[model samples]
Target: MNFAFSLPLALAAALLDVTVGYPQAVYRAIGHPVTWMGAFVAALESRLNRPTLAFEVGRASGVFALALYLGAVGVVAGLVSSLAPSGVVGFAALALLASSLPAQQSLDRHVLAVARGLEQGGLAAGRSAVAKIVGRNPETLDEAGVARAALESLAENFSDGVVAPLFWIALGGVTGGALYKAVNTADSMIGHKTERFLAFGWAAARLDDLVNLPASRLAALWLIAAAAVTPDASAREAWLTVARDAGRHRSPNAGWPEAAIAGALGLKLAGPRVYGDRLVDDAFMGAGRREADAADIIRALKLYRASCVIQALALAGAALIAQA
Candidate 1:
């Protein structure tokens, strides 16, 4: 991809996502690209992740499956970029396509529903709403647990769904962004240590971590800066928590943004949690109150929005610099 063209294209896509997001109408009409990737991954997993298969065979099949998925997504995005005129019209077209990949508005909307549910209907309502966003077993979650799940999901998705795509688009244009989404989709679908996916998801999980490293760190920085301006959010606490607790989470990359949000909002996150029948004994991320409420979810959303603004300004500045 041309660096000059992609720089502004990334900025434009970010702005467009913040402004309009992916419309539900469009999603209903053609379905989102991420969902399409998820369908493909699910099909591959069902076909390749046979319980009778040897572990090494499953692992090799997984690697090949992911490579195929990435190659297909990259080729399609490359075609989109190549077919367009390398002019204002082309940039706009690419930016519009790129906008569908990011999840700023979609994330905020889902998180907000959880907060609203908690406020209006208490734990049961919150659990129902939060279930839509988190993978954990929400059946046993209390009000605080539901709220914490929402906040954590907001932070983690902020990294994977927003910053990661922006990072890739700046470096590799629409193809890069789509490829990241494909990998992320695979990881979410199959990258589990469970009996079913332990071998089949190894490649997806590792590659997702590698690609998200830079974006996750940048997400931490954005959270720290956003904390400086957001009410009830501590920039110092964000930095300290990230330094102290980011390495504590199970994921190599998810911890950065989760810890940053935890410290910024003065709420602890990511302690022992239940996913299906298994329990994950994850370390706490912040040394603050453990009982998160709807108010805390709102505060996290504030920090998330602020972080997005920081990302946008930085990308826009870079685009301007490239033009100069």
Candidate 2:
């Protein structure tokens, strides 16, 4: 529960996730932790966010629902961690549970699919593959747009899907990680400025933003460092882009990693994009070429993989220091 134990636990979990991703068989049998959390989120939105309630009342209900979700996940994870036997077996069990938190392997698979689709198939294939990861409308995207969307998703998710969970685990062990994931799931499900979610999901959105603040910065650093060593990446551009253009992003935290990757790879990202009928006119990050392609996705994937190694090594170092 403390750093002495939790640091090593997190290191183990990250390694397991990288090497042995959550298997298809296991997922098919019981679904993943995130899926279970999604179901709970859906049920809460249905039961609590009623149209009949006043805006304030619905908002208050949403806050209460978020509290309930976090409480449930945290308590269960805490119990499991507490009841685990001492030594390797206990740590292994905890690692197995924690492995479910990071979606690194799955993220890689999803991004790679986009790259393959572009390389092997065509624009339609690329759009179909990118559609799975991004909320943007895929029908209108060209090949370059599809590649950009995939790369953008990779950078943002590297922070939310991988780094954020590890950050919480290092702080509060199983309980902390579980609670962070629950809140993040809530944000993804209902956190938006849309009429339906703007008021009702304010608390979840704000909390997710707060928890992700530090991790988002840390993720930026990871990418910058990884870029310094990568063959085609520009570390200087990454740092400059992050500093200059990250703030231009609509989401306070998402722009950091996205801008870093954009600068590192010398590609422009986050320009005008469509979501359904809505056109989001976001400022561009990284003043580089806007014509991204399948090759660019491969480069982004390399940067992503290198960043993962850096993160794992950093966590392992922290664990050793904690033990010392």
Candidate 3:
């Protein structure tokens, strides 16, 4: 599929996801696309990423594993896309499936849960809620830390979970979105600097970075626009942060949205933090305050919601132009 058709398809998918997110009952019954991809990633890593392999061999195995995973995802998505009937009915059906690719509603729910946890249950509750979404050790966090982590996750996932899939679907249909999700899942599961994954996950990590490039930048712009319209947010600060500090983060892509939102919301993010037992010394994304709280989380959520609206409008506008 090309942009002419794919743009509306993506717009429809985004609308569906935002209005009617994947039902919990459905998720419990069939799991998610990401989970399905995770199972495949685990199996491949278990089989191909043997501990006995040399570094070069393991790296090669990683490349092959990534190829296999993406190939399988593409084929499955293509087959599923084909099952839809021709015309508008088929487009609706495909959009329904593609809706699962983006997590706008779910991300909002999860982050909002953190804000509620902080407001209602204090630091411990905040930690519990944030732990569900963040990889960092929850116990290490105070209320401020928990809030910051949640906001950081919100910004980063806005790029990965929402923008990335829509971007791919607008380019290559649901198959492309599924492929991007698979690569992202592979990176999450096995892409690490640990001894076991350093070599075996290199390809997945690198490719994830590469594929996310456009979406990451776009997500930042979406946030910048959101800030411009948001009452309390500073669009100028968002732009300035993205220009100055987005490149400072260790991650090649995550810094874009994080910096924009952090500056827009007047908060610091992605500074030195602990994940599990490791204390990763990363550069800060914005020169804003570090002591954020539940109110700040709410502000960030406002921006996130605004950004989603912006994304939908962009999709609609692009589709209209394409049709014309």
Give the Cα lDDT of each candidate: 0.91, 0.92, 0.94
Instruction: Give the poorly placed runs of model 1, Cα more than 4 Å off.
Output: none
lDDT rank order: 3, 2, 1
Superposed model 2: Cα runs more than 4 Å off: none
- Report the Cα lDDT for candidate 2: 0.92
TM-score of 3: 0.98
Measured with C-alpha atoms, the lDDT of residue 155 in candidate 1 is 86
Candidate 1 lowest-lDDT run of ten: 44-53
**Please, what are the lDDT tens digits per residue for candidate 2 over residues 1-324?**
579999988888888898999988999999999999999999989888875678898789889999888888878888998999999898899889998998899999999999999999999999999999999899989999999999999999999999999889888888888889998999999998788887779899999999999999999999999999999999999999999999989989999999999999999999888998899998898999999999999999999999999999999899889989
Model 3 ranges off by over 4 Å:
none
Residue range with the least summed lDDT across 10 consecutive positions in model 3: 44-53
Q: Which is the winner by TM-score between candidate 1 and candidate 2? A: 2
TM-score of each: 0.97, 0.98, 0.98
The better candidate by lDDT, 2 or 3, is 3
Better of 1 and 2 by lDDT: 2
